[model samples]
Target chain A: MFDDRSPIYQQIANGIKDEVLSGTLKEDEQIMSTNQYAAFYRINPATAAKGFAQLVDEGVLYKKRGIGMFVSPDARGRLRAQRRERFFADVVDPMLTEARMVGVGVDEIVAYLKDGAR
Target chain B: MISLRDLTVRYGDTVAVDGITLDLEPNKIYGLLGRNGSGKTSLLSVLASYRRPCAGTVTIDGVDPFENAALMRATAFVRDSLDVTDQDRIAKVLDFAGRLRPTWDAGYAEHLADVFELDRRRRVSALSRGQRSSLGVVLGLAARAPLTILDEVYLGMDAGARAAFYRELLADYLAHPRTIILSTHLIEEVAGLFEQVIVIDRGRLLLHEDTDTFRARGVAVTGPAAAVEAFAAGRTVLGEQSLGGVRQVTLYGALADHEAEAARTAGLTLAPVGVQDLFVHLTAVGDTARTEALR
Candidate 1:
């Protein structure tokens, strides 16, 4: 559903981000070439290129010039940093706000995470 | 603003655009995506002032475009058929467009001809499909109309030519920006060109959204069947399939925090949906989020 509403490259960038966060892709790993990614995703090579550029901008991935994009040396760290930066407003804050409405306690959540971890 | 207001177009009894109402802003490229015979052409024709709608109005900047001479002059339609004289040569087409189109650029057209290796003396009807499309491109770019409409402008161009077209399009657009509406089947190739997208399915307005918001509208969640189902609960499911032990459900709507975290906890893949993926699913899908089923 490529539409005229927004540039497709932005979407391609987000797709790569999702792949990274999901661990389907690993840090310091080689990503597919532009042509390979395009054929695999059935996307335009230009769109894929734009996506890689976006990742490079976010420090999630970096280009090694003639080779291809590789998950950055600090890709996981960078992603974790970005996600952590947004955690309060995006996840923790929203979840807390919603939990308060349902009368759930912050202690309960922390305890749950601690237990969930174990 | 460009408006297609409750427009209905027909060819005798075959209804084209059933009734579409859209408000498009100025100075942007719009991608019109849909299946074959899905009324993308008819709707755009009305919008571009080429064909009048049967039941409603299409307006550019405020005036109805039907038979509106001023709008037609300001709007350039560079489709496969733009009513060229049968005997007119390729040079004549350029000359004609140069003379009639409000923003005609003769020098630019000549430059395009040189770039495409097109012979100025070659007649229009005698050209190949690729050449004809290039001619249309040349006309479209040089016309510089405020609103330029192209319906499948490149149907037969080879790979190299298509690449050339893309580069030229981007270069021209950057240098001389204008409102351009493109109707095409090659979604992925041109999706990046659009600033906005309008999807028309069987004459109905499926969606009109910014490229970013549209791309983030859905995601594919894949993993063990039960885990996927648990993670996907209450989401707008676009399409679904599964093996004996695993499933992948394409979900619509923005992915909230809880959902993302839950998916991670459950070990499900959360994939972002692309424009091509959305178009295919919407055109070929029959899902719960659909507004009206096109019969």
Candidate 2:
């Protein structure tokens, strides 16, 4: 289900990017048509089209003339690179801040990471 | 596009719709929200040409819709009260619609009947409440009129049937784009489908804007009563309540990211208000007075 905090189109675009990053949607693979996505999610077709349009703008998806949209050839790699750039700020920093608030030391986290690595 | 200028409707001494003006763009889904006796049905009836306004004008495509055959042919309104007669079978009713409705699609109607599990052979009187609502949906969608209005057509449907109807409605809408207006109290259930929303109260227009902006205006902040009150001081407070020592204030305004972050750091929890919650609070009697006073 989509959240109400941000525009639904942005959420749709992010959802597709997540799929690409997870290898569920491969490069050059045709994705569900806007109509199909709208029907499946019970959202307005215009909203879904907006999301797809955003992805197209970002080079994450490409239109096939009269056919439909396909994941761009470098979509996964590009998505991975973008997420990697934000991971520290968006994920790790928050984790570290929460850990600090809970009295979890950096050495404790390092030890836990080392044990999990084995 | 559709426009209503100072439109008003009255029944005996009661004013069902007060003077109001609104313009709706074409091919977009609109959600019409209101409390009971708030003139929602009356307003829609005027738009669909089911009733003539006592004053002002209702126009579709720049011409008066009242008794205008061409415009009437292009508008379809399905009210909670089924328009079909009790003597007619479901198939016979659809057949009648196919003959009268300019854009009626019999094939699609039949497909919808199958999906809704409606018995075409059954008499209108013999069907259950939910089945009748399903039949109403089928007629509305298959008509494919340029302007389609459904006033709480999901009145008796269960959750599953309602979900099915939403899916079919959105699909058909995408396949053939047209204007749609859905009037319902079930805001959260169908808010995602709306492009814009129009809310009315006591026969007067209260709010009309894109759904996102309307939703963003409502937010809830909860924490110590003193902090909650302080943070909500200058904002438009829709509603508020307290439990034990914790208090929550529902506000209607844009809260900047830094402001929200400050609230969080101050040990307050900020949450976005759902469409239903906002609708209820906005239309509630006491809150309406406060809102009007503020305006």
Candidate 3:
């Protein structure tokens, strides 16, 4: 099921990326065709196709002439690299901002992280 | 493509469709949305060639559709009512449609009947409201017309039946692509099935755009009253609510990346508004008054 908070196509693309990153979808693994995805999700085929097209544009998936879409060989690695690039700004920075607002010092956050590591 | 130019429909002294012009591409599902008395049915009737527009013109692939036998055969307009003789059995009605519709697939119709659990022996007058609706679904989907318009064909179906209808519709559409226009009051339930959304209000075209674009147009910003208010200051606020120190303002525009970042940095949480919620806000009584005033 998809939430309405963002474009469904974006969500679809993110979902496939997550699968690829988690190794659930291996390199060259053929995924559901856009029509199959549409029927499975009870969505318009055009919307589902748009999501698949976005993934292809980002090099996360590849087309196979007349067959179907397959996961790119470097999809997981590229996705991981992309996430790493945004980790601090998208995740840690927001967390640190919240921490600052709550009057928690950076040392306290560092100590908590150290404790969790153990 | 289907084109309508300044189309108008009137019944007696009342103008049902007023100078509405729109272009719909082929082979896409369009959600036709409108409040009660918004002329959605009137517009669809004209498109289906059930009636002529009082003014202006309607063309399908560069040909006038009104009373054009070939075009009529290519279009299927299934109304909320079954539009069959009460004395006829369900099987007989479908047989009639198959004889008239060049694209009608008897096998698909039978399959859809089974999916909807329709009894072929039942007379039209004997069927329940839900059963009648299911029959309409069978007719609309099985016809496989290039242009299929269903006008709130889910009027009395229960939740399970409606779910089945949606699933079957998507599956069949995938297998055999065609142009579909569904007019429904159940916006949230069927919004996902639409590639494009057309909204009409008070016999006027309100908006027509890709469904995703329409979905992204409304954003709800929630936070402290001051922060929320500040973020919504120059925006078109669709609706708002406040509880204790928290305020949520629903805005009618897509927020730019930096603007969304600014809201988040100001501690405001941005949420996407559902299509139903956006439609409600856009067609709300007060908003309609404001729209009329602006015009």
Best by TM-score: 3
Instruction: Indicate whether candidate 1 or candidate 3 has the larger DockQ.
Output: 3
Every candidate's DockQ is 0.09, 0.57, 0.78
The per-model lDDT (C-alpha) reads 0.78, 0.90, 0.91
The local distance difference test score of model 2 is 0.90
C-alpha RMSD for every candidate:
10.9, 2.3, 2.0
- The digit string of per-residue lDDT tens for model 1 on A1-118 reads 4444344577677777777888888988999886566555544454567678888888888888788889887777777778889988998887987999999998999999999999
Tens-digit per-residue lDDT, B161-237, candidate 3: 99999998888888889999999878888888999999888899988998889989898889999999888886777
> Candidate 3: which docking quality band?
medium
Taking the tens digit of each residue's C-alpha lDDT, what string does model 1 give over B56-108?
77777788876877777888887776567757888887877777776898998
| TM-score of each model's chain B | 0.92, 0.95, 0.94
Give Cα distance to truth, residue B225, candidate 2, Å.
1.8
Per-residue lDDT of candidate 2, residues A5-58 (tens digit): 666788899999999999999899999998889888888877889899999999
Model 2 chain A is weakest, by summed lDDT over 10 consecutive residues, at A2-11
| Candidate 1 residue runs with Cα over 4 Å from true position | A1-118, B285-295
Residue B121 CA error for candidate 1 (Å)? 1.6
lDDT string, candidate 3, A13-108, tens digits: 999999999999999999999888888888888889899999999999999999999999999999999999999999999899899899999999
